[model samples]
Target: MTMTSPVALTERQCTLIARALAEPRRYQILKEIAGQGGSVACACMQQKHEVTPATLSHHMKELENAGLIEIVREGKFATLVLKRETLDAYLRELASL
Candidate 1:
């Protein structure tokens, strides 16, 4: 069987992603960012989630750490972009099992 994803994810990365997504709010946050298509503003996320700034930051940090998203900072504004390749790799790995 031909089985391989173009992008590869390390076991550690997959574990991290699984753990991060295990959190309901984090999963929702990821979905919202993905739904935006690209470059979602942190301010808009906070407003939509109605969570405290610190709480949002924590969630973003976890996603970033899991390599599920990237955070770009300019001045005081922060933007998030979904790491589709990484997510895709993780999904591929899961499907392999």
Candidate 2:
């Protein structure tokens, strides 16, 4: 696999992504979201991961800031969706290394 063009990722974006994935739990959370099809309810993730609401919220925010996930909120419910292109670009960069 080849890495995407350097222009596709700024140094700051790469750093943010790396930081977001540095934590094991955060990485797992990302994987879970990716595996859950198009999108998943935060409540469902809470049940699956057995984490407190606040903890899950923190993880989600980290992923969102890294551009790895997108969240859509409707009133009290929030749905989490994986940003496949960002993850794919990151993986391609890793493969290039």
Candidate 3:
């Protein structure tokens, strides 16, 4: 799939991305998903981070809204996958600064 280039991002999108990453817990959540190299179950993340279900849901929503991750829902379970292209684009934008 084609990826969005961060250089082409609108101001609002940039703000969303920044806000999504501003919290330490959210950053850690992203790192954990990335480290998995594929989709990670929400249950796994909850155990790894020791976060409450409600808190995890909030963090996942932020990541999804920012285009930083994709969530696949199967039954009552959800799995998270990092949007590597989005991250690459963000890095590229940073390097341009």
Candidate 4:
């Protein structure tokens, strides 16, 4: 799906992205999701990161708030997908400044 581009990023969006990424755990989570090249199950992330379900949920929420990732929940299963376009836009925006 198409997403907001660098030229389209608002100040609020940039701030959210920056804030979300400031967390080391979130950045590591983002890296893992990106390295996967597709969706990663929540269970998998928890296992890899050794985080509690509650903590993982909190971090995921922040990433989602920043538009950096999308989480799809089906029944008890949850999968996360990185929003590459958003990330690329954020990076481009930073470089442009």
Best TM-score among the predictions, by candidate number: 1
TM for every model, in the order presented, reads: 0.92, 0.85, 0.87, 0.90
**Local distance difference test, per candidate?**
0.93, 0.86, 0.86, 0.91
* Model 4 lDDT tens row, 4-91: 4344689999999999999999999999999999579989999988878899999999999999999999999999999888898899
| TM-score, ranked from best to worst | 1, 4, 3, 2
Error of 2 at 24 (Å): 0.8
Model 2 TM-score, all chains together: 0.85
Q: Which is superior by TM-score, 2 or 3?
A: 3
Pull out the clashing pairs in model 2. none
Model 2 lDDT per residue over 1-97, tens place: 9886533666788889999999999998887887878588988889988878898899999999999999999999999999888887787777777
Cα RMSD to the true fold for all candidates: 3.9, 4.1, 2.6, 2.6
Candidate 3 residues 44-82, lDDT tens each? Answer: 998887778898899999999998899999999888999
Residue 7 in model 2: lDDT? 30
Candidate 3 TM-score over all chains jointly: 0.87
Candidate 3 has which clashing residue pairs, if any? none
Candidate 1: tens digits of C-alpha lDDT, residues 1-97: 9976577888899999999999999999999998999569999998898789999999999999999999999999999999998998899999999
